[model samples]
Target: MDKFLKMTGFATSIISWYNINKRDLPWRQNASPYHVWISEIILQQTQVKQGLDYYNRFISLFPDVVSLANASQQDVLLAWQGLGYYSRARNLHAAAHQIVERYNGVMPDTYAELINLSGIGPYTAAAIASIAFGEPHAVVDGNVFRLLARCFSVELPIDTGEGKRFFTNLANELLDSTNPGDFNQAMMELGALVCTPANPDCAICPLRTMCNSYRLGNPFSFPVKSRKTTKRDRYFYYFVHESDKQLAITRREKGDIWQGLWELLLIESDKRLSENQIVRQLSESLNMAPLAVSHVVEMRHLLTHQNIFASLHKVKMPEKFNLVTFKDKIVVYTGRENLTDYPLPKLIEKLLAQYFDLPPKVL
Candidate 1:
């Protein structure tokens, strides 16, 4: 650390800027542990704009850990609809139940206690401890990592174990003991708003004087990370069985993608399948009677870890064909007017929009 770049000076500069420039996010104003916890989980790997509505709805329905615990998993998944990470919702529900059962509905106030909860990582624990309980623990997340990398011009790869350890220590050193809450927020806010990964606004940055990357005139090159995982592509064949104006759909089972959510009858393939293969699989799986298949639509959806290739087959129900097997084998629907009530992925929603000829509507 530089002589003039101590935590006190860093805290003063960033907090001062944050007081005036911080975005008036709902989570920022609410100090409740439950609300903060929800916001943190929702905001992980998701943008603020996308997570805000879910936060508001979640807080409205399940205001506390008790309420969240009491709610059924289906309801929680319904609330978490369109949010890609299903594991987060599952973990949230688990944590809520744990807090209610073990902690007597009171959220644990310390980092250690909170971190012990399932799915509450170090970043989440530190955030809840400092913001909700006023603990003096340093919160080092992606935003903090970016800020610290540029501040000291750290050369370690942020994706590596040593890089994470180095930045964790650096963040701990820079935390303001007196106001850890505000200092943590300031650090995260500065990275999100000013020292962004792309095209950082160094001229307006409060810590430009002390930022090593700024001094070197290359603010975007620090905090290098290596990519280890390659994205795998998946192909899905969805059968939209419209009968008397109702669209048939079913809920996905446990231990699968989009688990416990309503979806059209699907046939997933290891690789992108041809049109004939898709039709054969759909017919065999659904046990659909002899019928005429109309337009086959294809759509591609991109996820963080995998590429989703969807092919929608519109099968017009035969008026007199045998219906006992299809009805008993799967849940059939007659319309899609109230489809939004059920939990669904954003990709599925996108496919639905095109399938039903309906434009996208914000939830």
Candidate 2:
């Protein structure tokens, strides 16, 4: 078959399969520019099933760009609590403000303009442009990458710049320009539901007839990556100082993980430390001795590039002491009941639920 004819058949099969088999999602119900943008951002590092509730809540809270722009960053972060990779939330908030300011509360329709907005990368911009604005841009997310790599049996490392460009161009060539929105969604849906990373269901795939990887019986081997991630181990000691039903908390600074989120007073170390070492460091940092100290809980939190071994300890302060007098400028005292009002890291949230008797958040 001629290359163009073969590609047309592939796209037609994908679009037909999608129209018949696509999942009925809330975002698909109304592919407004705002809805698509929000859904895409939320789904960046998250699965569809996990992001659904977050999306509903987020849309309910800030239904449009103007509302999102007007809301406080803390409120946005609070709504985004459980969905980690907090930078995405922050960037979404930033982009909302940008859209409001630059475009007068209107989402830019062009791919070039959308890409310039905060947190809107090539894939996201393409998604919005094609899905929301009827542009011919092809989205090349992990799903599309895997689909194209397997269909053509491309072995280039996806982590490399060369591999990215090749796959991107191929996706553009294969895109059905007349129906870019459904076509893009179809490509992604097929990858998510059928061409999964582990044990793809080639039997139901529309492209299986032309999939080189299926013919070679190595569907899992085509989407190759050159780089291996090395995760660093970190130890976090959280001292929950309570006095008169108040708990000490602090906002994480800009240069670290969970930035802009609130947490208990923390002492971070590169390596795990003994109890005596923890106590000595706490004393030195706080500039006073705790009346009593006891371990509460220990949890292992995993991030993309880091493994955090967090230990929570209860520290009893003197009855007359003032938290404001502490040398650590970030420390602040809040009512124990009000901890839920502030956005907290998942580890801290779990600690509160398990050890502090706080009700677990449903969303």
Best by TM-score: 2
Per-residue lDDT over 1-363 for candidate 2, one digit per residue giving the tens place of the 0 to 100 score: 246345668889999999999999999999999999999999999999999999999999999999999999999999999999999999999999999899999999999999999999999999999999999999999999999988887888888999999888888888899999998999999999999999799998988888888888998787999989999999999888876777888888788899999988888899999999999898988788887889999999999999999999988878856676333556778886687789999999888777756566731
Candidate 2 residues lying further than 4 Å off, grouped into runs, are 1-6, 325-327
For each candidate, the alpha-carbon lDDT, in order, equals: 0.82, 0.89
Instruction: Give each model a TM-score.
Output: 0.92, 0.96
Cα lDDT of model 1 by residue, 195-301, tens digit:
99887999999999888898999777877787766888898877777666667777787786787777776778879777677667767765754366655678888
Quickly count the clashes in candidate 2: 0
* Model 2 error, position 98 (Å): 1.0
Displacement of residue 133 (Cα, Å) in model 1 is: 0.7
Clashes of each: 3, 0
